[model samples]
Target: MRVVLVSLLVVSVTCLPQGAPPTVCQTLMPFHGGGISPQGGIPPYSIIPRRQGGRVAITVTSSLGIPFQGFLLQGRTPRREILGEFDQTTTQDGHTIQCGEPADSLTHNNPGEKNSLDVIWTPPDGYEGPIVFNATIAQSYDTFWVGVESPPVDISRRSVINDPSFNIPRQPPTTTPHYARPIAKQSSTEFDPFYSGCAVTKLCFGAPDNCVINKSCKSAVAVTVSGDRYEFELKADNAAWVGVGLSDDDKMGDDSVIECVTRNNRVDAYMSWTSGPPNSYGAARLSNPQLGIQLLNGSVVDGVLYCKIRRDAYTNVNGKVFDLINEKYNLLIASGSSATASSVSFHDLSFLASAQKQSLSDVSALAAASKLLVRLHGCFMLAAWLGTASVGILLARYYRQTWVGNQLCGKDMWFAWHRTFMILTWALTTVAFVLIFVELKAWSAEKNPHAILGTVTTILCFIQPIGAYFRPHPGTSTRPVFNWLHWLIGNSAHIIAIVTLFFAVRLTKAELPDFVDWILVAYVVVHVISHLVLSVLNCTAEKSSERRVTSFPMKDLGASGRNSGYNDRSPDAPFSNVRKGLLAVYILIIIAIVIALIVITALAPIEETWTTLKSTVMDNN
Candidate 1:
């Protein structure tokens, strides 16, 4: 019994070291099985690239200067396939392992803590694609993180012409001579065939709607169908990567994506999956045994990246088969400036989806999802709060005594204009509120406070008119209560509405420039100055009168002559001309501000629009 127990104790001790497995090249997961989750914070280690002629030297070091116990590193293609061989001569504290290919991956040999590891990697001969070094760092057996990656490395070949007479090498021209010409035959090397059959023999989708014909698209895609084969062409200017996704709906999640990435001065194509938003944890490379996609041609010339790909008509992605011939899908196009071997960054340059699902076999132009409603919503809101509401409040507050004797349609001139402007405010606000809801179709998911504040302002504005309709008569006992409540609600709503407009500048959909904040600030300054000028003028006029007279009108004061410390003034009130001139100036300034804001809101993403306009003007000049 003692001999058997000794053998069992030896076996248990041997198994205890299984936490750091020797065969981690395949799954890349530690065998620490206590149900501990991987760390969710930023990893402390990073991979640095140091490349020479045909080889890349990679160093995995603690970014925070914290030592690590174990690590596994590999050079991978954009599709996350393990590539490149590690040179054993330069590898330290690690050894190469076979991950579907011989010596294609490296892992730590022991569990000892180390500050850094260095290795030299060589790409496959004649391979000119995007490469990145990915690492998994283990601070301890139970505390490790995966998907830490380095920046992409450029390793493309450069074609040069050597002149025998001069014995000097010259790089090839970066722009094609026939770039501005009409589309040529597929067999011709003079021009690109991407825009050849757009909208006539193939279905094309692009931004600006006329980019296919004009050849000025910021991003575009075309699909050509031939029996069981579907060919796709993608193009984007000044982009690190461009992709087209086939989604069941207009949104992004659960979609299959085909990307054309610019790296190493060349373009390469890959298949990826969009599991959620296009963030670090959302997009991932598809690991299908057979991708059924072939890259026919790819190039980057004059800052434009183009690629042509051939894919099976029926392709499986993430266990679902997408049929291009009979079924319809929404085409989502996006481009950005950053990408890794296994994921893409957010689409900050351009992002759009087709207005409706489209069949790949149909040769028709696709329309982009319209932002017309969004623009209109912004215009209506600005006109209501900034234009109508401002004028109405000014007329009710400071101009009530200035337009004393004049009557229109049996109502005082001041009251007549004030009621008309306020009614217009109510109508415009209601319409604007409805239009925004129609555009979004649901509550916004933005993290900003704009949506919440706008909703609250709209609710308060809607309640103001209803409360006024039931207000007591001017001399009634509850008249004072009604006046105070009216003043409180009206001022609160106006202030909140202006504050909400400031937040609108930060909204992604607004796309307004940073200078827009200054415009709002200018409006606030002018508005406050106008109020101060009017208040001072009113005090001067009251003191000049021989008898004490109330500045507020009888209707506003809301009490009998003796009941309240107020009385109505004569029609010939002092400072009438000065007040009229100030009112005119204020109206002009308000109109100018409102028009400027509305124009900016309508032409949002204004930086691009301004650039285009400046280019046009320069060309004309």
Candidate 2:
């Protein structure tokens, strides 16, 4: 008997499960038809007095998944009518009603917490209930102020709450492709029961309610079945914004795994039939249901599980659905265990009819603004670059003319032009940084990535000026070191600046798509060609006089360990070495770009573009 008792004691302790931690989301003051007050009072905009069928419910369970014995849900409005009340013992399939005695056990309570209560209510009556609310759950959401204190963050907020107030727009009378051939089908499957998170179906309206009001009715597969699917046809008088619902998350709460597609204006998704015991089904008893194509104003006449539509909202680009959650959120599931989403397919027949295209002038405000931004910066760059080239060549020509007549280059010439170029560059950079920062400060879902890239680019550009300090005064130790530093900073600045340019293009609203790199490539080409043209013209005209004698001496010109007599007339001039070095740098940059492109291609799925390019290459070959 002692040996058996000892073994049983060990098993009991070992088999005990650890209690779950309390939710980070604190309780929220219940909302009447009105908003919640800070001092725990209901507001005037809340449910009015003596209305019927208005109900709200709150349930507070112990952290250990045990019930608060004897504590029942209880709430009454000023009218003294009970709108909602929690049961002392609520029994579900496997759960027993309050079978344990009422005890305030600190062991199952959150440390340092006060009273634990759930507040559910039906307005005082006569009120239509709250239309929209800015309620704080547990965490702050977006820029919308939840409160000074963080809101109770809801892990999964579920509700069987239904609103009959929606007038769901009737179909617009018109002829469109959506009304043509349509595929709406259903499969033989049962609804799944509700569990932990997500929604489960029940006969909320009762069987006699006649869910369909004399419309096309179909049954489990044929005659008529009162199911959860909503059916309607819209002319797409506007766009469709569909919400996703699922099972297994917090009961009555949202499944965070689903996210809106990038092309919000047009969406496509596959439907599930009996996916993993969906709201009502048994394993091997059902198949994963399939969804036929859906158009903007068409019908899901076939009773499919999912529908596809071309939407009107276009801000969904670049949005990711929970990919970074595992690293950022503790509650996230492992990548291998979670559901793998099948790619959705949608075909919009009325895309052309419902499609939106704007005139150049309509978008000119932004296009003009983008051009102004580039012009605001580019014009300055062109002036500084071409102006410096102009002044330098002009000064060189003037000095050559003077040398032909037996004179030396002027002393103040370099200082004057260099100071002017430096001042102009400084001004352009300052303006660019200030304006770009202001533009990027807003948290726009559509433009945040571009804004971030712009900010980074602006910061890198500031390095160019720091590098310029290396050339404080020419004739320093290896004057060329300053030149090299300046060159490296300049090249890096160009890369970052081009990155900013792309962001700008992405942020600006334009009728036609504009790629920043392509624009930059064009701008740089034009700027360089202009500089080269001016230099060559000046060089050609003054060649004869350039050979004229100068007192600076041939020894100094060739002192850098490379020589070319001042009067040398050969195919390879010494300054030509400077030109060759510049060309080589450009070639190296292109080689780097090619290598980076190859690496990026290998890392990501770029098969679509690669296949097209390969086909073209094959055709050319």
Candidate 3:
């Protein structure tokens, strides 16, 4: 009887399914223990949230339409604590199990393939913190993934907190608040409460200069002073982190930084210090217990990260003291896409500094860093490369023989016009190069090659006129060498300049639209077609019996044009009228393209400009 009982126990153990154990309540990991690693790519499944009445209805569906066999889903807090309860009666193809709390986790009840699963979740009463739905999906016993999360859904509280009349209880200086909830009023017209009383009741700073007033800023910060306590609100759209720094100067190093970072679907406010360039080292978090910074409320909803923090008016960080009432400081606002548990990634999306330092006690609008110099730099470059340089090169290449017997200021018409346009190109490029250096005040920290390429193009352009002045005499043995060198340098500079403009679109400071590339492509197409037509006309002129007037001396002309003259209105001039007509058409097209590009450059971030203009027109009407 003992042997029969032992044999039955062994048989039951071996017959169990090789999947997640039925006791997976806390660790959420599957029981497929063969030392296999989970998949590293994005999971094929996603959790979709829909608000039905006061409760949330969650649906787990395959993002790529690939059916899943098993999954474990739960609602988690920022601290990784389980919250709320899942209704087992309303769950489809799944059953609720307790994970530290009653009915707090949901998992597959059967191994059958399912397209989706639906469950209703009710938040704990009076809980206003954010909740994220995290899941571990299993396509098969061995193929599974862990830690897939959905966008956070914020729970509404019974009372509003951002009202001006609401008062917050002060805590000890050494103790920072962890999860204090402040509910901002939400409406269709004014969805964010942070913008209320900005620049009037509090000092506001943001990018794009006047975006705070226009209500169109992607990132912004506001500070309100009440006696020894300073309340700060940081907000940004489509960002993982947003921060504001207080610096004595406009630069970033050795500054006091207040950061609002979204990690695990919740926003946490922390104090940090900028040590150097972001490429070398990002802002380092301060670990002092006496930092005196408190996070009042924070939430990450629909890709927007919002945080409200409070700090003592007098506080010390890393041996440096900040006196909010007596000290003046520049405000720097920056936002980026990513952050780790300990450090934030580079702020590549937006970085704006105030025009001047101001006291925290002052409640007024603050101006952002001036983009006037940057805009001027872009406009000058467009005028140089697209307008002057293009026209100069065209005249030198194709119209040299077309404007026969014409004299402008004692020089051939083509040569005179070419020299004028080339001079303008040189002047404009030099000024633009200087303007950008003045605006940046140092080397660009961006990883793109726009600065390096622009410098090389300018160097080549500067030498062109100098090289021409020292050209060898006509018909000399070294004249051919000079001619070829000039052609090579000129063409190289022009091509490199156009390519540099393409890189400029990606520059954060330029703020140009992506479709600007299509405009550039159109210019190239038209320019090439014009060149082809001119080349065909030149060939026809060469094959005709009538001799054409050569721009150079007759000896330098090709064998077919050895009989050509250098005087205007020569009876032997071939197709002169047709060449003149084509030149006129080409000039008109070049001017139109250059004007369009220059206007776009001067008014970058064109979407905002259009909106502002449209609003103004409606107001005027």
Best by lDDT: 3
Candidates in descending lDDT order? 3, 1, 2
Per-candidate count of clashing residue pairs (backbone under 3 Å): 0, 48, 1
Question: Which 10 successive residues of model 2 have the least lDDT summed?
Answer: 216-225
Q: Note the Cα lDDT for every prediction shown.
A: 0.71, 0.28, 0.74
In the order shown, the candidates' Cα RMSDs to the true structure are 15.1, 25.4, 13.1
* Residue 220 shift from truth in candidate 2, angstroms: 37
Worst 10 residues of 1 by lDDT: 176-185
Tens-place lDDT digits, model 2, residues 170-224:
2232332112222112121111111101111111110001211111111100001
TM-score of each: 0.56, 0.28, 0.66
Question: What digit string (tens of lDDT, one per residue) describes model 3 on residues 386-497?
Answer: 8889889888776666655668999978889999999999999999999998877767766789999999999999999999999766555676667677778998999999
CA error at residue 141 for candidate 3, angstroms? 36
Total clashing pairs in model 3? 1
RMSD of 2: 25.4
* Model 3 poorest 10 in a row by lDDT: 171-180
Question: Which runs of model 3 end up more than 4 angstroms from their true locations?
Answer: 1-189, 251-254, 275-292, 316-320, 340-343, 546-573
Ranking by TM-score: 3, 1, 2
